[model samples]
Target: MHFELRDYQFLKVKQYLKQKFLLFSNGASQTSTNWLAVEQSLSKSNLKYYKVYNKIALKVLTNSVYNNIKQAIKGTFFFLKLDGNTNLLTKQQLFKKLKSVFFTLLSIKLNNKIYSIVQIKKIKSLNYRSNMSIFYQFLSANLKCVYGITYKKISKQCDLNT
Candidate 1:
């Protein structure tokens, strides 16, 4: 089934991504409250993330697009110190590479979200119990790491097995 993210959820994702480089939503498909928590966390952080829709790549550069690209190039040059490896790139080549990176980033701005949807679909379609269990185990482990919580300890504190 096809699904579209709601506007608030989309905004939440943007804010979350700005403060955090990545996001992973947990809970079954029936539960969307997890995303609400994510949104709240994002709001608290005052972070704003840029979104790039993966399905649509800009083929033409309108004035605004051109200006954005120019700003991106300038920002890249400002933040990126030229290293010895730059010796391998002529000024023209470096400019080309930066432009390439700008377009690439622009094209995949929503890549992580797209990829997450794809992964969620795969997880939902799984029929094998063992496979689902294994996937959940892996996800839980990763979540523990991301949250800096020791699952074993928490589970024990809650009187549950690790």
Candidate 2:
């Protein structure tokens, strides 16, 4: 899933950071009276907090469709055209090559001084046993090292370790 942030929203975020405001929110809704009271109390103090509403629309694709598009873009089929032998590389070797390629694509450069702050929510929604879940854990750890990133599971019903 991908999200596109508008230029205006980016400007608003910049403005908030410039003003040194602490941002707080409980997802999309602010119906919780206790949270609102906390916000109000913080507003009265020197340290102020602004309530932010986030609206996210996700587009999900199945594994087959996603893999087809990825392979097409990456031109993985070019190998088949060069040599008709698809078994030139063993399954283990192919897996290792793909893993390295993905790691290279996802690696962050520390030379760049700018850092991004990322917040991931509802992580418990993902299947814990899936390879995608392990990939996310690796990605979260990688980003945490180079950038300010936080993972939050809002629901108290599930454990993060699971």
Candidate 3:
């Protein structure tokens, strides 16, 4: 299946216009050959795309970020006892902790090569899309209340403790 940034519901035209470049990945399960088609399509288009020239460096960075987030989530869940007693914290409290951990981890400087958390936040605010399927899936698996409820509603309900 082909993925297009324009197809994402969260991406608006104004936000899309502001982007200097796009980040593309066919996903971990796909081979590098799959990206060749995407690269060729991009070459013919006006938009610029970020390419990972050093696969080793990119893999290391990706893994480091993934592990850091994973650990943060684990620690937060453990400290809050969300794993054992999901109702110990309200939904809002749980979400607040998760968001805090996510952003705090992002704020740390992993290396000179990667973009800063500030930049990432700016892009995210602009509605620039990233592959968050895995991240959301991870959160869903860990936090049962996150699945069905909206954030605004979550704040008003102590669903986690229910």
Candidate 4:
């Protein structure tokens, strides 16, 4: 019965996505592994998605990405001064913003634990062809929505209280 319930949950998520390009994913935190499995399965289907996180979660995420809060602010200021959209600012203002964004994603901290970002060059597959649909889904699904706007929509009826 327990195993059947798990399968049911996975199937429900897949079906939900099949109907709507995006799934609300009320169970995202509990079903992390299900997401990986769904991504693997949906890799064949081309889909675009997005996720929304509140302000508090965003702060925590920032702290996690830059364990040293001081360094994070320094990096932010450095990048803004160098690449900020102002005619007065020039290339020599500070370090290159692009390089910092790329390099700084190496590690993130959560609950005092450091997590390293793994770069997998290639996925082992029976066919030589690459299926990047899963990558897109995963990337979009993790996107943090700003001010309740997940994506451009004609409708704006989301209840933010949840």
Candidate 5:
């Protein structure tokens, strides 16, 4: 979650970016480790890959990353902001979740209230995140209707009684 520090306010730009990224990557369960890299890659995939990261892949990453981040961190010190403000939490929980997100994206696991994001291994020959085809899965997920909308808009629309 990157943000522009305009004379000190730590505005919620990071939160908005974080939320939007999660919404876009809601399929694969992206851990907190490499959170920033994934975001940077997806944001600049056009330059990096000549196109936006696959919407389905992006949505998977967003959902997994955000969910992982939220669970590790509390639920107060956090609020989604986009131009205005959608603060629906406190600072403590907010910080915790964001921290967790970064760590989790990096593939770290939470243990005993402490984060351990350095013991990840790469020898598991397991099959994951590849079972579902992008076309069918995303189509079933309604990738067309909410395409290109910002996270804020998505959230607003997702809210009940709207």
Candidate 6:
């Protein structure tokens, strides 16, 4: 499945951040209710927590991929060469790669509620596993790292353990 990032989330947050900062100054990032505040604001914008999560996932993944390939020849032409069903990952490591990607994601943001698998199926042609499994893989892979341990080792280990 092909998926697109709904800018609805970032736009909502960016505007909210602008407003909060307008009122509260730079302290907004450190606001006591940061997570709840973001969540509530998103919901108010009619973006479910899941929708924001899915869109964020889509944005991060697409941008990561686009950056990696943006310089390789004409990007649009190159991208069109592949099967839309053929995801960015290699054939052998679909699950492991997805786990690695999500591990990176949750580390940056932890409060996501698992939404649709559309963001995921778009990542690999493989139907893949549940987002909960992806989350477990993220946590189990990183529980030991104090934010800097190599995800390289963790992801490989996760692939093996799974």
The number of the candidate with the highest lDDT is: 1
TM-score of 2: 0.22
Off by over 4 Å in 6: 1-68, 74-76, 80-125, 128-135, 138-162
**CA-lDDT, candidates in order:** 0.36, 0.31, 0.34, 0.31, 0.34, 0.34
Backbone clash total for model 2 is 0
Cα lDDT for residue 65, candidate 1: 26
User: Weakest 10 consecutive residues, lDDT, candidate 6?
Assistant: 19-28
Query: What TM-score does model 4 achieve against the real structure?
Result: 0.17
CA lDDT of 145 in candidate 4? 51
Question: Could you give candidate 5's per-residue lDDT for residues 1-162 as a string of tens digits?
Answer: 555544123223233334321211122345567645655643332211111223322343356543444432322122222222332433344335434343223222222122223322331211123323544676866865556456668788789546
Residue-level lDDT of model 4, residues 2-108, one tens digit each, is: 57854554454333323311212111232567656544433322222222233322344354433343332321111111112222322222113223222232232
Better candidate by lDDT, 1 or 2: 1
Task: Compute the lDDT for candidate 5.
Answer: 0.34
lDDT of 2 by residue, 7-126 (tens): 455445444433211222222233578556544543333233332223210111122222222211221111101022231433244224333322112111112221111212222221
Which residue pairs clash in candidate 1? Answer: 52-109, 52-110
List TM-score per model, in order.
0.19, 0.22, 0.19, 0.17, 0.16, 0.18
RMSD of 6: 21.1
- Return the lDDT, model 6, position 129: 52
Q: lDDT by residue for model 6 over 1-162, one digit each (tens)? A: 544445655555344322211111111222456656654543433322222243443344354422231122221110001123433434244334323222111211112222223443344332335545776888977886645566777888999999
Score candidate 6 by lDDT: 0.34
The ten-residue window of minimal lDDT in model 4 covers: 75-84
Local accuracy of candidate 3 as per-residue lDDT tens digits, 1-162:
776753342233223223333222222222468656544543333223322223322333354533342322211111111132231323244235444322122222212223434555443232222325655776878676654456657766767558
Consecutive 10-residue window with the lowest summed lDDT within model 1: 54-63
Of 2 and 6, the candidate ahead on lDDT is 6
